[model samples]
Target: MEKKQRMSRRSEQMGDQIEERIVTGVYPPGMRLDETELASGFGVSRTPVREALIQLASAGLVEIRPRRGAIVAEIGQHRLYEMFEVMAELEAMCGRLAARRITESEQRALVAAHQACEAARDANDPDAYYQRNERFHHLIYAASHNVFLEEQAAALHRRLRPYRRLQLRVRDRMGTSFSEHAGIVEAILAQDGELAATRIRTHVVVQGQRFADLIASLPMLGSPSLT
Candidate 1:
């Protein structure tokens, strides 16, 4: 493969690893990411690690400073609220369109996705539930059948990854989140476009606020990466 292709592939792999680490809480927000350390761990050169960091930055995963290097971007309460508003709108749009355009197969997949989430919750596995919850939303995006909307929603989703995981930190959130997912599916199954949209929007926004509150209640939430 050409150098560019090699670099692209490395970036993709590194990006996925970084995302997993962040989502699994291995690397918390505002935590400095040492490129040299990553490079050694990946058995690659710092050049590729630098490229991966840049990729993460573009995905809103990290921020590069003048001399301090790259650190995971901290989701502040203000940005968290703004991201929630945007995500709620995006999810609402998806729900509205999916109600009109969702195929039988896609609808089945949505049901299965939610069921998987419920199973994870019942098993008391926050890790599994968190993963499935992500898929559930992504399945909704696929059902919508709007390329632009899917891309926008996906980008926003990437940006909100940290907070999304932290949402599960709320007390009894597994059951509560599962209930919210049930409501969303109920609206979709009924083909209630307006209701589906409204419910999903409220669900997303409330989760966003809840995440913000969770962080605020934390004794120490690292430090601000951007500000």
Candidate 2:
């Protein structure tokens, strides 16, 4: 690959690593991003780090201030709630469509994802469960067959990743999430469009609530200043 392609690939990989850290709450929200520090951390140059920041900014995952610096995006309760509202509608639509359009292969994939989550939960592995849970949701999104809805829901999911991970950080949450997913799969399997829609919406709304609860009990989440 040419130097340009190499840089692009490196920037993309660095961006994915940074985004994963952000979503996993390792970076947390509202934290300042020092380009030099990030560059050193990744054994790269400031250019790639800057490029990654720009990519994250475009995704609403970070904010680049004019001279202040780049920082993880701060989110308010209202904004979080708004995201849930929009996401719930999108996921509800996906569930309704999926109930009507899901294929046998998709169903089996969903089931396997669910089983993986259950196994992770049984092992008391929050991190592993979160990964499988994401795969399970993505399977449903794909099964819906609405490209626009899939894209929209995926964007929302990306934004909510850190918060969702926080909720799962609570003790026994893996089990709870696994149960919720199981019910969601059952609703989809029965071809109960309305039921699936309602359940999926409630599932997401509950996520928002769980996030709020996590912040309330921990307080570390909402207190991170974008400095």
Q: Candidate 2: give its CA RMSD in angstroms.
A: 3.8
lDDT of 2 by residue, 1-227 (tens): 69999999988888878887876567867789999999998898999899988988877778899887998876555666667678888888999999999999999998999999999898888778778888988888999998988988888887776567667878777777777788899999999999999988887775455755756643323433322
Tens digits of per-residue lDDT, candidate 1, 56-134, equal: 8987778899989998766555565677789999999999988888889988999999999989998988778988999
TM-score of 2: 0.81
How big is the RMSD of model 1?
A: 4.0
Which runs of model 2 end up more than 4 angstroms from their true locations?
Answer: 1-31, 67-69, 207-211, 217-227
Pairs of residues clashing in candidate 2: none
